[model samples]
Target chain A: MAEEITTTEEKTVDKDIAALLTSPPKRAPEPTPELTGKIVKPKIVQGAAAHYKPHVAKPEIQEKLGFPGTLVENWQEAAVAKMRELLGKYKSLQVYMDICVRCGSCTDKCQYFLSTRDPKNMPAGRAELFRQVYRKYFTTEGKIFGKLAGAVDFDLSLLAEWYSYFHQCSQCRRCSLYCPYGIDTAEISMAAREIMDSIGLGQKYTNEIIGKVHELGNNLGMNEAALRNAIEFVEEEIEEDTGVPVKLPINEEDAEVLLVTPSADFFATPHLESLVGYAKVFHQAGINWTLSTTAAEAGNFGMFVGSYYHMQKIASRIKQAIEELRPKRLVVGECGHAWRVAYAFWNTLIGPFDMLNQKYPRPQHICEFTLDLINRGALKIDKSANDEFVVTFHDSCNVARATRMGDKPGGQFDIPRELIKAVTNKYVDMEYDTIRERTFCCGGGGGLLTDELIDVRVKGAMPRMQALHNVMETHGVNFMALICAICKAQFTKIMPKYGIPMEVAGGVHQLVGRAIVLGAKE
Target chain B: MSGLTLLYTLFAYVAIAVFLVGFLARIWKYATTPSPLKIPLTPAPVNSVGVVYRMVQEVGFFKSLFYSNRIIWIGGYLMHIALLITIVKHLRFFFKTTPAALAWITSFEIYVGFIFFGALAFLFLMRLVIDRTYYLSLMQDYVLLIFLMLIAATGILTKYYVRTDIIKVKQFVMGLVQFRPEAIPGDPIFIIHFTLVLLLLIYFPFSKLMHSGGIFFSPTRNQVDDAREVRHVTPWAVKG
Candidate 1:
C-alpha cells in the first residue's frame, strides 16, 4: 500500500514535469533535473517513435517459415538462447556487440534519428536496445555491473522496443561510413530481428514476403502463369509506347541472357516502366534475354531478416533456373538490396557458376549491360528525349554503400549517374552529404515498406526529402531517378506526403527507355 | 615484505594476468570466428593491399574519426596519441638504459601528460554537454573516463608538483617485471594513480576497451571486396 502511494506520487510528479515542459509557465526551472543534465536541446525527444511499431507477423506466416507459431511461453529464455546462437554464428554480431564506445559520431548519421529527433533512432542508440539485453545475458561486466554497464534483462518491454526500433532501421549501412570502428547497426538490426523471430515475434512485412518467395517464387506471390502474363502485358505496353516490336521472353531455353528482376517490375508502376526499359535495351542491343518464372524475383527479403537459411532458399531458385534454362549470361534488374545479395552473396549462396560464361560477371547488373551498349555505340541514345524534366539520381543505400557495380570503387554511384547523363540532357544532384555512400535511405528499404510503418517511413524520408527540396529550389530538379524497386515504391508513396508529385520517382532505366533510339531495322 | 607491498604485488600480477589473458582470449575469438559472408561496406577496396591501406588509415591516423566529427576526432585522437606516446616513453622505467628513439620521444613526453589530461577532460565534458552522448553514456563510460583522467592527473602531479623519486619509481616498476617485489614509492598521489591503473587494467579486457583489439577484427573494415572473383567460403555456410 505504501509502495503504491509512492508510485502514484512519482507518476504525478512526472506528469507535472511533462506538463511544465510542454506547456511552460513564465519561469520555474525545468524541474532542475530535466534541464540540468542536458542543455536545452530539442533534438533529444524521448518517446517520439516509441509508439510507431510495425504490425507483427500472424501465426500462419510464422509457421510457414518454419518458426514457432506464436510468441513462446518461454520467450525470454528463447530470446537469450537465440542471441547466444547468433553471437556464435555471426562474427559481425559478436564483434559489434563488444566494440561500440557510444562516441556520438553516428548519432547524427542515421536519418530516422535526424528527422524524428528520437535518440533511440540513432544508430548506436538503436543498437543499444539490443546490446542492453546482450549485456545482461552474455557478457561478464554486464552480468556483474548490470545497468551500470548498460545491461538490461531480456524482457517483454525490451522485445517491444526491439520490434519498434529494429524495424525502424532501413539496414542502409549509412552510419557505418562515419563510425570510427565501422560498426554497422544494420548488422545489429538483423540480429535483433532474428532473435525476435526465434521467440515467434516477426515483422509481418519481411517474413510474409520471405514466405511468399518460398510459396510462389516472389515477394508478390505471383505464380508461374501470372508472372508470364505480366511479362506479356509489359510487351504490349512497350509496343503501344515505343511503336517498336519488343519481345519479353519467359522460360526460353538457349536464350543468351537470363533476366531476374525484382517482382515489383512486373506489377508496380515506374517499376513496370523500368521493366519496359530492360526489354527495350535488350531489343535494341540485339541481345537475347528471358525471364525465368522459377526464379522470378531478384529482391531477396531473406537478407533483410538476417536468415542465411531463407536467403539461401530464396536465391537457390536462380540456380534451379540456370540448370533448367542454361542461359549463358545472367543479368539482374533495378532492385537495390536484392542487387546487393546477388552481387555480394550469390557466390556464397549459389556458387561455382562455371555454367555461365566466365567472360562477364556471373550475375551482371542491367545498368552495366545498357551502359556497355551506349559505350560501344551499338545502341544510340537521344539525350533530348528526356529534355522536359530536370533529373537527379537517388543512390539506393545497398548499392551505394553495401555493394559495387562495374568493378570500380564507387561504380554504384558513378555508373547510374553516368547512365543518366548519357540518356538525359538535364541532370542535377541532391546535396553532396546526402548522395553516394553518404546518401540517405529512400525511407522504406529493409522491409519497412509496409503500411503499418508509414508514419516512421514518412518521418525517415525527411532527410532525403529535405535534400530533394534543395535540388528543386536551385535546379528545378523534378525527377528522382532510382535503381531500386523499394526506392521507387517508397518515393512514389512518400513524395505526395511531402508536397511533391508521385510521378517524380522513377528508375534509371525508365529514362533509358525514353532516350533510346531504335534505328530502322537492317 | 610488508603486507601492503605483498598485497599490491599480488594484485598487480593478477591484473597483469587478467589483462593479457583476457585481451588475447577476445582477440582469439575474433580472429578464429568465421565471417560467413563478404560484407565489406562498399566503395571498399577490391584487393588485399587496398584492405591493408584501409586498415592503416583506420588505425594509424584515426581517419574515419577525423571524417566523422571534428570535435570528437580532436578529443579522441589526442587521447590516443598521447596515451600511445606516454606508454612508449614510460618504457624508460622498464629499460636499464632507454633506447635512442624512446629518449627522443620522451622529450615530447612533457606535453603528453598534459595533453592526455586535457583530452580526457574534454571527452568527459563532451559526454556531459552533448545531449545524445549524455543519454547514451552508461555509468561505465563516465567511470572509465574519470579513471583515465585521475591517472593522468597523478602522473602529471608526480612529474611536476609532488616530485616522487624517479629512481625509486623506476626501481619499483622494473622490480615487478623482474619478479622482485620492491617497496613502492609512498606518495599518496602516486599510490592512487598506480591503484587506479591496476583496477583499469583488470577492468579493460572485460569492458568496451577491447575495441582496441576488436577494431582490426571488424569485417566491415578488414574484409576485401572480392566476392565475385573469389568464392570465399565459411565452414558452416557451405551447402551439401
Candidate 2:
C-alpha cells in the first residue's frame, strides 16, 4: 500500500509538469471596476516582469537545431560573431555608437518610460547595453575597463536583459526625431533581436506566432477550416441584421478585389462586423471579390518579434494568395500595423511577383476602396444611419507614419475623411490632433496583446486615451473611428478603463454597411 | 615691423570679410526656406517645473557628457568648446587697449587655451580616423578642422614657440581695425594659418557645417513632439 501511494504521487508530479509546460501559469485575476475604477498602473517591475516572461515552450525550436546544449553554444557563438561582423562592417552602426552625447531628452520622450518608469526603459540606457559592448570590443577606452566604458561583459545575464528590454521598445521612430544627432535606437533594437533569434533566444510567443503565420498563414494559428467557420459565423450575423443572405465568397476565380484583415477579427466582436460591411459594399456595387482561405490574414508578425526569415515567409504566402485569387485589386482590411508591414516591405520582399501571372495591382485600404466607389458613383451612402454620432478619424501610427501610402495626400486618411464628410454634416474634429502623417500609436503595439500585459498596454495608451477623452469630456465629441486592427482593439479595450464613453469603430466601411440604402429591385 | 605682422594682418582681414559675406548669405538662404515650427529636441515646459527640468536635463544627464554613441555629438562638442576658448583668449590681438580685467582674464585664458588647443587637435584626428565621421563628413568639415588647427597652432607659436613682437603684431591688427591698409605679414606660417581661417569663414555659409546655426530649422529635431496633441497639416496636402 505504501508502494502504491509512492507511484500515485509520482504520477501526480508528472501531470503537474506537463500542465505547466503546456499552459502558462495562472495569473492572479486583474483588478475589476468594482475594486478600482481608476486605471491600475502596473508597478514598474510588475509590468515588465508580466509582459516579458516567456510563455510558450522553446524546446522545440532548440531541438530542431539538434540537442539543446550544442544548439545553445553554437547559437551563442554564431550570434556573437554576426554582431561583431555587423558592427565592424557597417559604418552606420558604428556611427550610432560614436554619436550619442547621452542628453536625457529621449528619456521622458519614450512612452515605455511613461508607462513603466524603469530607468532602464530610457532609450539612452537601452542603447548603452549595446554601446558598452561596442566600446569594450572596438573603442580604445572600452578596451581597458569594460564597465567603466559602460559595457558589461557578454554573458547569459546580459543576454537576458537584452531579450527583455529590446522587446520592450515598440520600434517607434519618435525618439529619432528628438535626438540631437538623429540616433535611431529602433535599428539597434532590431539588430539585437536578430542576434537573440540567431542564438535561439527569441521570445516564445513571438516566434510561435511567426511559426503559425508560416504554417497556417495567420498568427492566431487558424487553419482553412477555422477561416471558413469564421466567415459562416459573420454571414449568419449579417443575415439577422440586414435580412439578406450576404455571401462572403471564398476562392472565386476572377474577383475585382480580395478583402484581407488581421485574424483578430476572426475571433473578436464588432470587428467581424467590418467583414459584413465590406460584403454589403461589394454586394450593392455589384462588384466581384473573393476571400481566399489560404491567405485571409493581413498581418505580418515578423517585424513585431524581429525575425526576417519569418517576415519573408509570411510575405510570400500573401503574394501566393493574391496570385491564386487573381483579383483586379487587393484591398487591405481595417488593420494598422498589418497595412504598414504590407505597404512598406511586401513589395521589396516578395515582389516583382510578376512570375505568379497576376499583374498584381497595388494594395488599397478599405477607406480608399469605399472612397473610390463613392467618387465613381458606384455605391450610394445615406447619411441617416451615421447621423447620430459626430465622427472623427484617429490616424493610427502605422498607417500615418510607418506606411508610405498614408503619408501622402489623398492617400489612406484622406479617402476615409472624404467619405465621412460626404455622408455626414455633423462631423467634428477631435479637440486635439486630426488626420495626416502626424498620428499617435494605439497602445496595443509590438504584439503586447497577451492577457498578461493588458494593464501596461492600457497605461501606455493613456496619453492617446487622454487626448480623445478630453475631446469627449469637453467638446461633445462622441465617436472615434480608426483603420488599424490593433487600434480598434486598443481603443475598444482600454477606452472603458479611462471612463471615456465615446463609441469606437473602424473607418467608414462599418458605417457604410449600416448606411448604404440598397435597392429593393436588386 | 615684424614680417609675421604684415602677413597676419592681410590674411586676417580677408578671412573676416569673407566670413561676414558667407554668414549673411547663408542666413538669407535659411530665411527663404519654409520651416515654421521651433520644436526643441528636449522636452518643453508643459508645466512650470518642466522648464527648469528642461534646463537641468540639458546638462549631461549621464548621456549628456559621456553616454551617447553618436560620433558627431562627441566630436562636435569637443571641437566647439575648444574653439570658443581659443578665440576668447586670442582677444589680445584684436583689442588696441585691453581693460585691466580683460588683461587678467586673458592671462588665465592662455593657460586654459593650451588644453583646448590639444582637444581641438584630438577632434581633428577623431574625424579622420573614425569611419562614420570621415565618410559622412563633407569637404567643409575637413576645411573647418584644418583651419581650426592652424589658428590654434599659430596662436600657440606666437605665445610660446616662435615668439613674435606682440606690439608690432598689434600695430598691424590695429591698423586693419582702424580702416587703414597695412603691409602683408612676412612669416609664411602666420600667412598660411590666417588664410586658411579666412577660407573657412568664406565657405561656412554654403556647407553642411551651418548645422551649428541651422539646428533651429532642422525638421527632424526641431518639429514639436505634439503631433498626437496637435495637428500638423503638411503644405503639400491636396485638400478634399
TM-score of each: 0.94, 0.64
Q: Encode model 2's per-residue lDDT on A236-354: one tens digit a residue.
A: 98888778877889889778777777887777655765767788888888888888877778888777754445666777777788778776777788887787666555655554434
What is candidate 1's lDDT per residue for A1-522, written digit by digit as tens? 999999998787556433322311232211101111111224789877786767678789999998887778787898888888889888999999999998999998887887677899999999999899889988998999898888897765677778889989999999899998999998999998888888888888799999999999999998888888888888887778778889999999989999999999999988998988888888988998889999899999998899999999999999999999999999999999999999999999999798999999888898988898889887878898999879998999999988888887998889889899999999998877889999989889999998877777787787788788778878999899999999999989987877889998999999999888875644
What's the DockQ for every one of the candidates? 0.80, 0.05
Q: Tell me the number of clashing residue pairs for each predicted model.
A: 0, 22
Which candidate has the highest TM-score of all? 1
Over 4 Å off in model 1, which ranges?
A1-42
Model 2 CA deviation exceeding 4 Å by range: A1-57, A61-71, A74-76, A85-95, A180-182, A353-361, A406-412, A430-438, A501-508, A520-522, B1-240
Positional deviation of B232 in candidate 1, in angstroms?
1.6
> Per-model i-RMS in Å?
0.8, 13.9
Worst 10 residues of 2 chain B by lDDT: B35-44
Chain A TM-score, candidate 1?
Answer: 0.92
Assess the local accuracy of residue A469 in candidate 1 as a C-alpha lDDT between 0 and 100.
78
